[model samples]
Target: MTPVLSRRALNRATLARQMLLERKDISVLDAVSHLVGMQAQTPHTWYLGLASRLSGFEPSQASTLLENGDLVRVVLMRGTIHLVSPSDAAGLRPLVQPILDRDLQNNTMHSKPLKGVDLARLADMGRRLLAEKALTAKQLGAELETHFPDSSPASLAYGVRNLLPLMQVPPRGLWGRSGPIAHSVLSASGSLSLDEMVLRYLAAFGPASVMDAQKWCGLTRLGEVFSRLRPDLVVFQDESGRELFDLPEAPRPSEEVPAPPRFLYDFDNVALSHADRSRVLTKEFYEQVRPRKNFAPQVVLVDGFSAAEWDVEDEVLSVRAYGKLSRADRAAVKSEAEVVLGVYGVRKVVFV
Candidate 1:
């Protein structure tokens, strides 16, 4: 009989893998790599994601790496920006290029203007321009317009971005700093194969199904890869009887394990990576805090599931629960909020 993982059991596994069950004493780079990379579309808020999973994490640890070129924010999974190591930036960009290509072809706004444009030539131009020096999209678009006069500059720049492996250089992603969104060519490369990438994904976010991996990376047709690796991988079924794949040695703790409250940044992969988010986000809570106008709220996790939405403004961290919490859960949420506020240098928290 195939072992069945209940929702709570799956939640515990996800929390354990994400380091949310307990803060680990790992280096920031190691944490980033272990989790396969964080969804870091937002700039400084991503530091909070690290703070939640790492013990004694300091913003400078990652900031220095970004400045020195050890870490990069690039378009990879889902065609959104992610904070990743140089090697991952090189490897994943090419692997997920199809996502960008499909987006370019189907884009409601940019596709029409980009039609009939020589994308290969545009990519060449973008590479040459970025090689000389990093250029903002606006600047790169202006330069490309001189050559491709028929295409809209904005559309041309959008097309180039999809067609090339451009990374956003600092101080754009550095903590406590700000800069224009500038692009530069990524010169790093990695030989990580699709098989290896899938294995790594399972190591980080698994006991997940094939759909979950596809949701994380925005790539389709990975069911075949999972099928190819099935003999080497352990398999289980969720309560719904959906088959879940995992590394043989990956930790899947007891369902009754106590889960500490965790604060997540708006774009944290933990909430967004899975096809069925019931492991971390209950449908009722999701309906209560569903994104407004595509804006996902930062979340507070209680008992390993999203229970509230949080925001900080004017030195006040405000938490709004999706439903009534037990007295103990309320205290736990408050305590975790304080720790989160300390990371932001805020001194106050309020529940509403």
Candidate 2:
């Protein structure tokens, strides 16, 4: 019989692997590789995600890396922008191409406009245009429209986005720097298979289910992948009898282990990566935090579970409890907030 792992057990183990139990003294490049890349559609907010996990993390350090091309923002897992190392961008983007293909094909607005268009030609044109100079999606689309005037420039741009590997150039993602979000062709080369994605997901957010892995990557039919990897993975059952898989040597700490208060960025993978988020949130809190479709609240974790939502304005961090925190929990939240504020060079934390 597969032993049942309780929710708290799952929570502790996940926090340990995610570096929430203790901040890691690792470099930003290594951290990006380990987490498999962060959901980074929003520029500066994502840097806070790294700072929360890595000890002595500095925004300038990450900015410098991005400037040097050691790190880049590209479309990867879930067909969303992620800040990843160039090597990961190379390996992972190729694997998720099918998702982008499906997105472009099924988009109601884009599909009809793009029908009868030679996407191969458009992709070629996109590559050439980007090679000459980095351009925003709008700019790239406008140029392509000159060659295919009848097609929707928006559709043309969407086709280019799906077909070509483009990297968002610097100054766009740099801290305190701004520019038109622009794309240039990515020259990195590598490939990642679905089986490899499963293993990496387990390493980062494990003792997780097929549904969890599927949810994280926005890919379906992964049961077969898990089956093939069963020989190499440790298996257990969650309290509800859902089968969970993890790397054999990965950490599974006791339920009683401490998980201190930490602020999480909106759409942090730890909160969104699991189909069953009971490890990180209660059903009530999950619904409250994710009150609407596509809404993920910036949150504060108390005792390894989300307890409050947070916001920042002009560098003042504000945390609002979902219900109410006990006096001790509130103190813990404020104390961590103070440290986080200082990390960002902010001066105040306001609890509401």
Candidate 3:
């Protein structure tokens, strides 16, 4: 049997998957496939994910992508809405549809108002309106109220998000900006197919297990389709003995691979890997995930484990290591972090 990847080896591989090894010139769509997809929060960390990678990525660009119909904002991977290219969404949405539907059925936010409703008509109407022009969730809710006046706008909005394949108009997701998320109809969106999308996912994030796909995408049984094409793929297993799969030509560097410091966007695939995330994060780092007044934590990497919470404020990026690091590793982190100071053309990267 092939040996399991040691934690350090896994860290480098994770960095490679996440584009931390070296920046590539790929477009947003290609980058999206790599690392699977970015973790999304409305108008916030989502853009940071795109910003941290895309060299010229601007706060307005994410919105522009959405406005031009190149991207879609919808709940995906881990059941949170992400801003992804329409082509990826087309293929991925179908894969996660059941999980999303099941969640809606179980959640009171949508279940209550959508109960006994002709959901098909509602979805169609919502789709048509979005296709006509961009509208905020509130605006869409107002329109839905015109049809179902008895339903609360709040409830109808949740139901529409739960029912229709909606994409937010651009500017909503552009970096450094935040506001209402507008909607577009996925059916009206011309993008890639399910087969192509599944291929993209495998190409970018594979050597991964089925559960990793599910955890990253909030979908499962993609391997059902993948199993049919098993001949076209190479496979491996983790230390826990769970099966893993990857492409034949993909990179699988040897353990003890040297890695530099990486600044991760919150909830990016790097952090989300593994059912047990000890490969990238330890028990202590997980505790820090608890929010301090809704502020997103600035996570730092030491060796492989998440060693501290950090921040970029006052034109300075601070590294607060939770534990001590070896001198060489500390220098490595400091050197890499110093470049992040150049992100906005600043010269200050402070360590706490």
Candidate 4:
């Protein structure tokens, strides 16, 4: 009989892999690589995601890497920007190119204007333009327009962005600094085969169903990839009988392990990575903290599940619980919030 993993067990496994169970003492590059890169569409707040998962993490640790080109923010999984090592920036982009291709073909805004345009020629032009220096989307678009006069300049730029691997360069993602979005062509080199990527996914966010991996990467038919890797993977059934695949040696700690309070950033991958998020985010919590007008609220996790929503304003951290928390749980939450406040130099924490 296949072993059954209760939701709590699955939650613990995920927390362990994500470095949320305990802060890991590791370099920012290693942490970023180990977790397979962070979902980092937002500019500054994503630093909070790292702060929650790494010991003694300073924003400068990652910011310095970004400025030095050891790390980058690029469109990868699900066609969203991710903060990744330069290697992954090159490797994962090719594997996920289909997602961008599909978007370019079907995108409601940019597809029509790009019809009949020579995408290969446009990609060549983009590469040539970027070869000189990084250029903002607006600047790149204007330059591409001079060659392809029939296409909308915005659509031409959007097409090239989807067609090629581009990295959003520094001063843009740096902490406490800001700049207009700019792009440079990412150097193409080594790439990850589907087999290797599937294994990496299981290592990072696993004991998961095929759909979960699909959800995380925005790729389809991974059921075949999972099928091929099943021989080496340890299989388990979720409470609902969904088949979950994980690396044989991957951490699957007992459900009884203690989970400390964690404050997740608004776009943290933990909340967004899985097809069924019940392991960490309950439907009730989702209903209470659901985004308003597409604005996702950063959440507080207590006992390894989403328990509250939090934000900082005017140097004050404020938390609003979805339901009542025990006195101890409330204290733990406050203590964790204080740590976050201290990292950002905020002075106070308040419960709302």
Among these predicted structures, which one has the highest lDDT? 4
- Estimate, for each residue in 1-352, the C-alpha lDDT of model 3 and write its tens digit: 6657555665566666666666666677777656556657555555556555666655555556665776667776666776676666665676667777888789876678777777788777887777789788889889888988767777777777867777665566655555576776676433555555555666666567777666666666666866766788776667777777667787766656665566666656667645556667778875654647555465676655677766777777777887777788778777866655354444576667
Shift of residue 46 alpha carbon in model 1, Å: 0.8
Q: Decide which is better by TM-score, 3 or 4.
A: 4
Candidate 4 per-residue C-alpha lDDT over 75-166 given as tens digits, one digit per residue, 9 for 90 to 100: 99999999998888888998999999999999999999999998999999999999999999999999999999998999999998999888
Against the true structure, what is every candidate's RMSD? 1.1, 1.5, 3.1, 1.1
Model 2, 1-352: lDDT tens digits are: 8989999999999999888999999999988888999999887888888878988888899999999999999988889899998888999887788898899899898999999999889999999999999999899989999999999888898899889888899898898786788999899877778898889889899989999998888888999999999999999999999999999999999999889998899878899889998899866575573567877688889999988888878888888888778999988888888776565666777888
Report lDDT (CA) for all predictions: 0.90, 0.88, 0.67, 0.91
For model 3, the local distance difference test gives 0.67
| CA lDDT, candidate 2, residue 160 | 94
Q: What is the lDDT of residue 130 in candidate 1?
A: 88
**TM-score of each model, in listed order:** 0.98, 0.96, 0.85, 0.98
Q: Model 2 misses residue 167 by how many Å?
A: 1.4
Model 2: C-alpha RMSD to truth?
A: 1.5
Q: After superposition, how far is residue 101 of candidate 3 from its true place, in Å?
A: 1.2
